[model samples]
Target: MGSAREALLDAAYEAIVAGDWTGARMADLAARAGVSRQTLYNEFGNRDQLVAALVLREAERFRALTGQAAREAPGDVGDATAAAVTAALTAALDNPLIKATLTDDTSGLLPYLTTRSAAIMDVFREDSIAIFTERWPEPAEHPEVRAEVGWISETAFRLVISHLIVATEPVETTSRHIAEVVRRLMRDLTTT
Candidate 1:
């Protein structure tokens, strides 16, 4: 993205972090970004799109970190999966936007964040698919194996998301358990 576009997104994110998305105006964002209102509109079209872009961008940042965790892990699949999932959960919990959207009962953005946030969802799903494929390329050659792993990755990611929002268990424990399940599933696919 151009500097102006990046600035606009950054300013919008700041507004969301402040829980002032409703109060945030094109003029405010433009001022924060050191751009004109026309420039902001030219980049994002409108506030809704700007918010969507912010969410997507933030989600992408988390996914990038998650992918890095996967890439940087040192041992086997279980260890690596644990690292990756833990990283994602940690980032989500730390991110102000995720915290605001998920934890704040009165957040006006909750409905849209939950129901219309396909871009955010895809960050986890697509990143998991890519990382799993990269780490276990042999499975991709088999259609059924690929499908099974995809399901496993999606389910594990959902568990991470749930743990982040609901917190039935400690994030570490839940992520570790999910990683074990994923490893077991992969072993079954290979052995049977």
Candidate 2:
């Protein structure tokens, strides 16, 4: 069952990479995966479900890559965040799903990253909170620290999303700017 599901996802990814996701029929996807149409439907329910699965998979991949980059970077949490953001932006530059979504405004896939991004953003938010909490633990008598951490996470994640949607500067430059902002915020929190 898992193999069939993976095959279906693989087939869908291939279609997207080939620039045919908008035109690819369920039957064609099932044929590519060597599965029946019923099997595909049973696995994913519909095209939107399949797309959600694909986007979630990509989000997990992003999380892993960014987590590793953060862990391996030198200096403080801000430095780690910069490395993670840089890794994500660099990956986005060549990521087929991102490319397809950005280049084809009519594909109807933009919602998965924008208005309908709760599921994806939830994953990123949880991960960011974990990373930040570990780096800056809550102090005794400071219950508001958690809220501050959440705000930082949301702000940083939104910045990355905005860049992905509307890139104005180079990846490294934007990444560094984000890091500096985060660093200032953290410094203020520490001093206050």
Against the correct fold, how does model 1 do in TM-score?
0.84
Number of clashes recorded per candidate: 0, 0
lDDT (tens digit, per residue) of candidate 2 on 152-172 = 877888899899999999999
Residue range 8-42, candidate 1, lDDT tens digits: 99898787778776777799999999999999999
Which residue pairs clash within candidate 2? none
State in Å the error of residue 186, model 1.
2.8
Per-model TM-score versus the true fold: 0.84, 0.92
Query: What lDDT score is found at residue 84 in candidate 2?
Result: 92
